[model samples]
Target: MSGAAVDAASGAPRRGEPRPKAAATNQQLRQQAVDRMIEAAIALIAVKGAAGLTLVDVGRAAGYSHTLPNYYFKSKNELLRQAYGRSVGAFRRRSGAWRRQALRAPVRDDALFSTMLAYVHGGCADPAGARAVNLIAAEAVTSLPGLLPEVRLQNERMLALLQDRIEAGACGTGAAEAPASIEALLVLAALRGLVSQHLLGVPAADVDAAVRMLHGFIEGGPAGGRSAA
Candidate 1:
């Protein structure tokens, strides 16, 4: 009830604020706090990169006491790790169903095209998560050695999946100009580059054009029916 006391250490309520309603149980409240912190961390990583993110920043960004993040996550590394997982989860939730279906079947060239299109669009659907993933990925190489293995595994899995799709669909159609392995790496690299450029303030129209160009190249054109150079 509103009259119930919220523990001071919980930091769930500020001075004079009504206690959480009875319908919001303590477990639910705790989960809400953790989710908020994770989202705040993602936003911070999107803006400032994960290299310098602190638990205090996460707590404050989430509108909680600066110590609350530490109470929940303990360390910046752990917080960033969880934030990364949450970002990945959000992307999967956005586009996982069709992707799973596509990967399981013998996709045609058009299906592969649709799958690639979905990958690009899905990455942009959650701008915060996309930017956070890119920023965190950059940090993994230079500033966050502890995150290297995890980041590497994430990329390797993606590359492998793309290659499988390319082999199963595009290569079979003779539309692919390069080896499936090479095509997969190129597609993965292009996607990453597009995301990085967009995060660096590239105009959306230009980014869209580049995506179209990527689709064109995959379909045997340099740009939507033009011959390749």
Candidate 2:
């Protein structure tokens, strides 16, 4: 008897017995395929840079037929956007975890500084992901206005943490003044610039030195402590 007949008689899904609720299974399969494609794309971008990424390449790397990526993503830009969104979400989660951990610690200034340093270092070490995040940030400034709300929320949370540390005298700044949001912005910008330079072939020692200098500045050292206007 045919597989379908056997399935009917045995009350089991035999071979390809129309798969009851197959739509759900198919949807799951599609999502899995898309995830694999995104992962492969990220790996490729890490190794080859975004300029070298192609949908066909992603499809082949993902173990899918050449047309599969096209089936899921209409264009390379869409894929890039999706990949970037995923990467940003992951970075935010990592930063959030560090923030939570820092908040739970003994409220030492060093602990807060160390947490920020670790978070930046983690991001810098992943060059492709870093680049992807920057690209998204640039795009958000123009093309994606909706992302601003989340970005602002994250910025506010980070600023609040820094301000709290500054106020608590944890920063050892001796300045008897709270740091302005601009100070936090400068610190973030400096770290990001240093990481971008490192990704462009700058030496680790140079990056380390720059990070130290910036940290010292934020902590009220001569280089970084001038009050924001």
Candidate 3:
């Protein structure tokens, strides 16, 4: 229980100084702090929006001293970027897990639909992360080269999965030929709009219905009946 063997939950060490055997646990505690700070940022961003959230706010929310955030993260943007990465990483993990699970089930329309439904629902559940991601996406387009490679890669992976399912004819006929990249962009746009509307105090039922409609549209239903113009 040396300093190197600090407990992440309590942020306290078993002993006053480090021991060679306890180095790994100490590193684990540091990682846990970084992770906890990111999580706190997510919650605060959701409630106050990214523009309104501060390092001090994030630290307090995460049960750390006001200065602790600075020790872990150099600036607000750095913290945000890390939080954004964590959020996207979580989404990828979920999608990957769902895909792996689907491989074991009987292939059917329901399976594809269910997977897509869960994907959209997961995004909806964390509106703050969704919003932050959308913001980063918009910026990445013009910010700098390779500024958000991970985000872009995650997006591509999501689109590829949808494309594969559609091509397999599980979703329907048009899906096979539809541009997966375009479809993914459209779906992300719709999700951002829906989340934004909700954040602006739009009714929950309306937001939920809109998301469902979007899911239907993506699955080759009559959801996208309107013209882009």
* TM-scores for every candidate against the unseen true structure: 0.73, 0.61, 0.60
The superposed Cα distance between candidate 2 and the true structure at residue 175, in angstroms, equals 7.2
Worst ten-residue run, lDDT, model 3?
220-229
Report the C-alpha lDDT of model 1 over 1-229, residue by residue, as the tens digit: 3434554656577768897766978899999999999999999999889987888888899999999998988888888888887887677666666566656678543655555655665677778899898888888889888888778888888788777876766632235557878777888899778766766678766765675667567656454434322
Can you list the residue pairs that collide in candidate 1?
A: none
lDDT of 3 at 7: 64
What overall lDDT goes with each candidate model? Answer: 0.76, 0.68, 0.66
| lDDT, candidate 3, at 68 | 91
Query: Lowest-scoring 10 consecutive residues by lDDT in candidate 1?
Result: 220-229
Kindly list the per-residue Cα lDDT of model 3 for residues 200-226, writing each as its tens digit. Answer: 678767765665566566655463422
After superposition, the stretches of candidate 2 with alpha carbons farther than 4 Å from their true spots are: 1-24, 96-112, 134-179, 197-212, 223-229
Q: Which candidate has the highest lDDT of all?
A: 1
Evaluate model 2: give its TM-score. 0.61
* Backbone clashes in model 3, listed as residue pairs: 1-14, 1-15
Q: Is 2 or 3 the stronger prediction by TM-score? A: 2
Off by over 4 Å in 1: 1-22, 96-109, 172-177, 200-209, 216-229
